[model samples]
Target: MTENEPALDSLTALDSKAPPRRAAVIINPAKSGGPALQGAIFRLCETQGWAEPLWLETTVEDPGTGQARQALEAGVDVVIAAGGDGTVRCVAEVLAGTGTPMGLVPLGTGNLLARNLGVDITDPVSACYDAFNGSDQAIDVVKARLNHSDKEQVFLVMAGLGYDAAIMADTVDVLKDRMGWLAYVEAGIRKLPGKPVKAQISVDGGEPVRRRIRSVMIGNCGRIMGGVEIFPDARIDDGVLDLLVLAPRGRLGWLGVVAGIFGRNKNETESVEYFQGKSAEITLEHEQEFQLDGDHLGTGTHLAVTVEPDSLKIRMSI
Candidate 1:
């Protein structure tokens, strides 16, 4: 086995001293580690003095919220989300406001939340151990809804509209598995060459502002691919959210955005603009795709989003 992979032959609940510490793990079977990952799970729990984690598996129909609630009902001290950002959002959404801490094991394509929280993904065993032993911190959560959709979804990292959403919707699963984050680069190349969505956006219930944009990213945690900081001032525990408007651009405009992203100072140039607010409402000229934490939420002409400060309790060192 590789150094990162755990080697466990017979998985069993370890006999431990004193009262057992209880934890629950909600796992997505389709993710990278697959069934073999369970060995690591059992081994980690065995060593951590945690009980054989009230194991719950996510199905194609149910991602993890229900199982997480079930775990909470059973009085688990921590709820661990063992999938990608989507799964993390699901479990976290349910655990929000309950004062229950949620842990993450980065196993999906974009482990954005885990990365932002400083989880060790290269070593699965270490990742699990970190989740089990981490300290507590509360982070902000955003709730978003598309036009004609009555249901609202929760996102922990960032949410987007237009080009960014298209990249997430169009990225192929096999390509993502084979190329990792390079898959997003390839998909962005394809999507960025297209037209930007024209829309009028209003922040914090303010007057409407019109702009033709490549993407509108609302970020709770600002760090993204390649260690680039989209909004340098954005903080996860802050009461507000940061807004980035990536405008219509050709090759040169793309270069300007790249420069702005890598540069130490913020650019208030015509190509990109930044704003901060507690809520945002957008009305699109036409149907544009929407995404949250890298998962597409379908096309919508109207969008509404709001931030809840210190909304979710997270189990992490950061």
Candidate 2:
């Protein structure tokens, strides 16, 4: 094991004090090497003297939300999401406000939330070890309600509308798998020519502010991939959501925005506008695509989002 890998066997001492009686693991079989990862889960749980966990396999049709809700209702002491960001988000939605502490077994590409929590994503055993012994931290969650023609839905983490969402929808899975987070750069470059769409935004009943924007990112946490500070001051328990609006006027302005990101100056950039509020409402001039936690959420012209402070209980190593 690597130096950063948590010593699961060493943590057995804690198990003697208070054994973990129950755990529900929601595993996504389609994630990379998900089948092999199962053995690690068994070893860790067995070491802790916990019963064989109730295993729920995620199906493409259901995406694990239903399974997670079922597990939560079944009264498991802990619910562990064993997949990528998408899987984590689905489970988090169900566990939100339920007082059930959620854990992560980072088996996803761009495990942003896990990274933010300082969880050991490279080692499944380490993640599981931390889950049982780690303390709980209250994190903020954003409820994004998209008013579609017939119904509405909710999102967690950063939500993107306009150029960034378009890039997410258009990015190829093969390239993403091969290049990892660099695929976003490739996709962003391809979409730069079509950037800067018009939109009107309102923050917590404020007057509608109109602008031509390349992308709008609603952030619950400050860091994105590559340790990029998308919103430098964003806090997971701040009780307020952060908004990063990129409205680059020209190619040079876009270049400046890129430089700002590299320099971690998102909060101080001229082309970027930042806001923190309890809620926000957005309306695009046309039907624009949006993404939540890296998954496309289809195209829509209107979106309403609100923040719930300390809404989710997460097990964190820190």
Best by lDDT: 1
TM-score of candidate 2 to 2 decimals? 0.89
Regions of model 1 farther than 4 Å from truth:
1-18, 249-251
Judge candidate 1 at residue 284 and give its lDDT: 88
TM-score of 1: 0.90
Model 1 weakest lDDT span, ten residues long: 9-18
Top candidate on TM-score is 1
Q: lDDT of candidate 2 vs native?
A: 0.82
Error of 2 at 41 (Å): 1.1
Q: Tell me the whole-model lDDT of each prediction, alpha carbons only.
A: 0.84, 0.82
- TM-score per candidate, chains pooled: 0.90, 0.89
Q: Give the true-structure RMSD of model 2.
A: 8.8
